[model samples]
Target: VIGVKRRVHGGLRFTIPVSPFDRIRALKQECDRLVAQAPPDLPVLFEQVLRFERMIAASGVDSVPSHADGLASNILIGPDGRIELVDFDGAGNVDPYYEIGILINEVFEDEKDFLPALEMFEGTPRPASLRRARLYAIADDLAWGLWGLVMDATSQRKDVEFYRYGFWRFIRCRAALERVDFGSYARML
Candidate 1:
């Protein structure tokens, strides 16, 4: 299958979404903002996952350039059924399997529910990649959780809805954290 990789000839005028590791502090600030706005009874699970992600960041990985923003909104389908990827704003050096986790978590309700996304990429995903995807999926949860908070903080038009969305994302992130087999994945490394 053929793929298109766009090349930029000069310095970009617009901002790009930095890779997750680089954006950790900003993301955490957003997470903190969300927590501050939330009630006292909010679950600690989101915090737990965020802390774990911080640990992962310090340990580090060899950055392989790939799309950091893989939300369903960025993908475009042609009339002839061909696929076109639109957003490169968040494309940069990061984990190779990064998008899989984002794609799986964003597009599916269950970890076991893998289909069109699983089929979208070439070859059956390996155990290592799947495991990494699971781990990264947890991270994606935190990212989206923070995103909701930003929306909640910024949007006047969707104030109530954004608050609900922010809290919901936190809850969702916590659930994904609970589902991760930390012990099993740790052993894999």
Candidate 2:
């Protein structure tokens, strides 16, 4: 048997007052802004995003799936900047790309810089990392979307705009998921 003790008092936590739902709402709004700004006939970009999502889902091998709760907030960074993961509450049965995608989303909000982070995370040009990151990013969107819904259900309608944002995120996530390359990722699972 193994036992782990809490290292720092209270451990790592964000100072941001926004709940997970608020963050998701913000992300959805940002996605909408980006999509609205895209060229009217940007099918190529959309196709590329789909291909990337497919690749990300396919990155992991069977038997050693990735951690499900790979969010940056769950990671504890020491004074020396080394990372220690906390709260494996959602652990197990995930693709390896899950962590990679989460990390990419946290550090690089800009789509342009996302590729570089993707390259570093995958450690190889598998092309699947792109798809995985996209999927993970969409997952982030979904997470926030649900968060907003939960807040609304709990009667926190003070932030109605957040719920609207969540709806937008859900729509965007669905759009992206529909184009994902499920075959590649499913084969590994």
Point to the candidate with the largest TM-score.
1
TM-score of 1: 0.73
State the weakest 10-residue window (summed lDDT) of model 2: 1-10
Cα lDDT computed for each candidate against the true fold: 0.59, 0.50
Question: What is the Cα-based lDDT of residue 87 in candidate 2?
Answer: 78
lDDT of 2 by residue, 72-138 (tens): 6777778997667677654443344555555565556555676776565545635555655566676
Please provide, for model 1 over 1-189, each residue's C-alpha lDDT reduced to its tens digit, 9 standing for 90 to 100: 113211221223334334564454576666566545753533465455655554455546544445566677776778998776677777765654566667777778877665445544536655655666666777676666666767777767763676677567767776767766666655553
Off by over 4 Å in 2: 1-65, 155-189
Candidate 2 achieves a global lDDT of: 0.50
